[model samples]
Target: MKAIVCTGYGPPEVLQMQDVEKPRPADNEVLVKVHATTVSMGDHRIRSFTVPSAVWLPARMALGLTRPRRNILGIELAGEVEAVGGQVQRFKKGDRVFAATLQGFGAYAQYRCISEDGPVAAKPRNLTYEEAAAVPIGARTALHYLRKANVQSGQDVLIYGASGSVGTYAVQMAKHFGANVTAVCSTANVELTQSLGADAVIDYTADDFTTRPDRYDVVFDTVGKASFGDCMKVLKSGGSYLNCTPVLPSIQVMRAKLSGAHKLILGEAPPETAEALDFIRELLEAGKIRVVVDRKYRFDEIVEAHRYVDQGRKKGNVVISIV
Candidate 1:
């Protein structure tokens, strides 16, 4: 099997294409021949090891000390089951599936193994491999934070970075949660955000959302571009703020406990639980959520794909076609 091997924690150039042994399934695992996979902010963070010190330290202890523990770099994949262990019952050799690998991040290769009880799900009938590959991470992140926000029917919710991968899904999910959605993005993305069901679009280049008078029930800073204090200014009494990028100032952590008007919630990708995967699959089947892909790269050019995602301006997901 061919895979993009991450040489070490550094720039995108560190990713190299090489021939590696194909992975086989264990007694309780299913071996999938990957057709598509993704490159996202998390992949870049791991590649360059740019995560915050607090997260970096703990993650280093778990992943490795000086370099990465695993050489393959993808976390999500959509593929066909080529073989199944004798104990596997939910799927057969020909079933198509999409799944997230919580820590076994080997989807960059042509074949990878997923446990029968993992986040793996039957691929939505309407989506292609590339499209399905983009959903697991972005949709799971959006779903986790929006549920934390607990948006109400008539309340207003603001999403920062409303045009990025998670932001795009956040806008749609907020609308699905019945909140009147206001998306914050640059001038170039106004129309795109509106098309994704944002009730209003705030062009950050022209207006400051935090300085506005109208207060929101929830302010979701998908990019972590603003601090908790900056976002708190526009929150209504009892409103909550969510940050997808994980960083919390000590004062804000303390303040959240004391004030009803302000609160902070940090996000993580939902655990690869059965219920969470089922919920995402249900939303996809109902047509309430969709994948937003910005670019597709051939498996051999995965190094270039990493560079594109590292640019930090991808409109949505970056996919690598493995098959």
Candidate 2:
């Protein structure tokens, strides 16, 4: 098997292609031959050690004191089951599957072994391997946060960073829940956001969304670029503020929640589950949601893919074809 080994946490150049032993399934695991995977912002941050200052020490300890504990850096993949252990009843050889490796991070390789009951599910019949690979991280994160906020139908919902990976999925998912969606992005992505079922699109470059008179029932900051205070000003009195990337000020919002005025949600997403993947698959099969792929790179070009994602301008998911 071939894998991109992350020698250490630093520049994208640290990722190197090398021949490695193929992984085998354990008694309760399934061996998958990867077909496609994604270069998530999480992957970039972990590879370069670009994390929030508050978690710097903890991140280092969890990832590795000197180098990555896991050599491969990918977090999600779509692949075909090549073999299954005797105890695996949910999957079998030849089953097409897509899954989120989460903290495991070994999808950059040609083969990986995962528990049959883990965050693995049959790929949607309508999607390609590349498309399915893009769903787990962004879509799952978006779904988790939206559900946490308990977003209601016919309510105003604002999605900041609407052109990025999680933002793209948030816009569509908000609409699916029947919320009147407003997407905030630069001028270049106005049309793209609107096409994803956003009821309105704000060109952040030309206008300050917070200055508008309109208020939202839910304001989601996917990239953590907006100030919590500014976002709160645009929220209705009882509206919820959801920040995917929380900073120090987010703590104030959490404490203020004790007053019972507004809801504040900021934290790591829940573990990815097969149920969530199945829901996404149903939406995909029904043509209710679609994968937005901004670019595709060959597995050998993973370093270049990381470089592009580091710029923080990709419209949706960036996929790496593994097979």
Candidate 3:
């Protein structure tokens, strides 16, 4: 099987294509022949080893000192099940599935062995492998944080970076949760955000969202570009602030927590689960949520794909087609 291996933590150039041993399933796993996968922020962060200097040592220790603990750097995939373990009854050899590998990180390969009970589920009938591959991580992250905040009907929700993967999902998910959604992004993404159901769109380049008089019940910084103080200023009392790319907690974040004036919800996304995948699958199947794919690349073009994602300009998901 062919796979893209991360030689070390540095730049996109470190990712190399090589022939590797194909993976087989365990008694509780399913072997999938990957048809598509994504170059996500997870791949970017791990390959580039970007983090705050404060947590640099700890992050290094957790990932790798000189290389990634998991060298193949893909977190999500969609494919056909080529084989299933003896104990697996929910899936068969021909079932179309999408899965989140997360920290296990082997989706860059032609084959992956995923736990039958993990974040793997039937692909939505309406989506292709390329579209389904982009769902697991982004959708789950958006759903988790929105639920954590217990976003309610009639509340105003603002999403920064609303054109990116997690941001796009957060925009749609907030709407599905009945909140009035406000999307913030570059001028290029205003229409895209509106198409996803954001009630209002703010172009960060043209104006700062913080200067607006209206306050929001929930403010989600999907790409970590929005300032904490600026977001805090616009957050209504008792609202929640969600950060998809969280850094060290600041004094204001702590103060808000101590005073019970606001809540800061940030960090790694919740571990993927079969239940979560099933829920997202239902939404996808029902057309309650939509997959936003910014671009697609051939499997052999993985390096080019990585370079594009590295630019931080991807509107939604960038998919790598494999077979």
In order, the Cα lDDT scores of the candidates are: 0.86, 0.91, 0.91
Task: Evaluate model 3: give its TM-score.
Answer: 0.98
Q: Give the alpha carbon lDDT tens digit for every residue of 59-150 in model 1.
A: 88877787788988899999999999989989899999999875679888989999988889888888999999998877888888888778
lDDT of 2 by residue, 142-250 (tens): 9988998898789999999999889999999999999999999999999999899999999999999989999999999999899888898899988888888746644
What C-alpha lDDT, on a 0 to 100 scale, does residue 259 get in candidate 1?
63
Clashes found in each candidate (C-alpha, N, C closer than 3 A): 0, 0, 0
Candidate 2, pairs of clashing residues: none
Clashing pairs in 3: none
Q: Candidate 1 lDDT (Cα, whole model)?
A: 0.86
Best by TM-score: 3
Order the numbered candidates by TM-score, best leading.
3, 2, 1
RMSD of 2: 1.3
Q: Candidates 2 and 3: which is better by lDDT?
A: 3
